[model samples]
Target: MSTAWQDLTGRARLRDAAIEAFAAQGFEESLRSIAARAQVTAGLVRHHFGSKDALRAECDATVLERYRQLKEESLQADPHQLFTHLPASAQGGVLLLYILRSAREGSAAGRKFTEQLIDEALILLNQSVSRGLIVPSRDEPARARLLILQSLGALVLHFALNPPQDPEDFAAVMQDYYSRVALPTLEIYSEGLFTDSAYLNEYLLATAADVPPATDAGITESR
Candidate 1:
């Protein structure tokens, strides 16, 4: 459990329990089960949040905010620390699993939750550019959205293919998954696949009518 879940009272305790329960068992997890996890009554849960839907929305907000905080902290640390912890923390963290469940459940709130994530990514990437940690993009919004999509899309596919026996095993499963991908991902980022940007330049020229030609450093980031 996260230290964030510790030393809680009333509504806060219920919220943390709901995050854990929903992450483990999906959104269909009963209020009674969540209440039991928090050592509270279901009626108390209803009293605080009114409905399961409201509780879920609250969980979504909490998860997103937690992610934002973690990422901001990583930005202030060694940039590579983020990727080093990505497999376990970002992939296996309860907050992330909860968001993934939201996306898989296909609820309206679920879709909105994902859109919110992308928006958050946009803000973070803009910060990165402003700090000169990363090069500015010709189309900043597109690049931000693409990075989030590629990352979360790959994670969604990973879980679908290798469904864990228990949610508690999320960290182990994701760590193993990242072990397989980490080297190649690092290599691709460190070493360009193509010898030159001829193909990209040609494509840019072809599409110049729609937008002005501008070269971006792809994924340039300061160490």
Candidate 2:
């Protein structure tokens, strides 16, 4: 392959490594550690990404890509298939952990990434409403924002009390909570027209099945 191709491959590898490291260990881990995992030098990491902050931004992008893929796959499968397939811990654990760590440390990148994630989620929720999956009231955006905030708060509380559990265990708890709390809350708030357990389950399944299209020009452009 040409030098450019090799460079691109290396950069991609570095980015993936950064994602895994950040997801697993947060920003506390050094760039050198990330580079070692990717089998590249720290200098190369800097050369390609320019700075740690920039590399972190790339990591956020990678995580978002994975999120989109998981959501698509879930959606395409039988309703709520992802909840059955992915442990609740793994589904939202990394992002939750990252958020908690960032907030505790007062990291700007973490805050920014979290905001971006929320924005993306809101967009998807609106899209789901348009598709007749969720029925948000006139104040759909506000309601959606509250739901996201509550869910994140729950995650932080859970993680604070215990070490991260296995994904399956997390998934089981999430399934139960969604069935008991989230679904019911949505129904009550939306006057039984916005979302129900069945609909939410179906939506979660679809999102898990979703495999974010390769040509996400529109998604990128929206940002």
Candidate 3:
């Protein structure tokens, strides 16, 4: 939040600050504390939101908007007859990190949130297959579970284990890791897993010419 943030209404400013501070520090942080972070007074915090609970609602809405944008961009129906394809580089920002932390704590609200996400995943996957947006699978429920495991699980691991503290540094790392590691791994899974595939063999054959020739001297050294 910088120059453009100056244009926001006081309420918007408070909501943005609440989302950031609460995500990093949890919802128990005081209104005064969030006000300080927002560079506003405690009076304004109450004036804008009336209560902490209302503030939390606004913060949640802010984050959910981010989630909505991601879903809209990622949910492709048909692309050149390739039913399954990777989205254009997935990302999760501060709001996602907060949600992960909350869910892992296993509070009633967190549990509910997790259940909703799982149900949504199941519904979306089942619909996609039923509508012929994706290839039919014998065990679609299992596939959906696997997808949630790989995608969301990787995110939880990254934020829970080790990620850069600085936002810019964190983004740079995500850019590289998602491009080089995460998405490719997903591609391999999307193409294989339940399907009959010779992908590995074909890949090896294509790249075999690049393999270095084994030398007798190296073999003798190994002995």
Highest TM-score model number: 1
- Model with the higher TM-score, candidate 2 or 3: 2
Better of 1 and 3 by lDDT: 1
Count of backbone clashes, every candidate in sequence: 0, 23, 0
Q: Tell how far residue 169 is off in model 2, in angstroms.
A: 13
Worst 10 residues of 2 by lDDT: 214-223
What lDDT tens digits, residue by residue, belong to model 1 across residues 62-118? 889998987788778875776777677633457657766876777799789888989
Tens digits of per-residue lDDT, candidate 3, 1-223, equal 4354554577788887787776666668899989998898999888767999888766765666666555545665345332233322223545455566556656766665555555556777676666656664444566666765566676667765665465433244445345556556757756756453366446545776753322421211111
Model 2's alpha-carbon lDDT is 0.64
Worst 10 residues of 1 by lDDT: 214-223
**Candidate that beats the other on TM-score, 1 or 3, i.e. the better one:** 1
Q: For model 2, state the Cα shift of residue 148 in Å.
A: 1.9
Whole-model lDDT per candidate:
0.78, 0.64, 0.61
The estimated TM-scores of all candidates read 0.83, 0.67, 0.60
Runs in model 1 lying further than 4 Å from the true structure: 1-8, 79-92, 215-223
Error of 3 at 122 (Å): 4.3
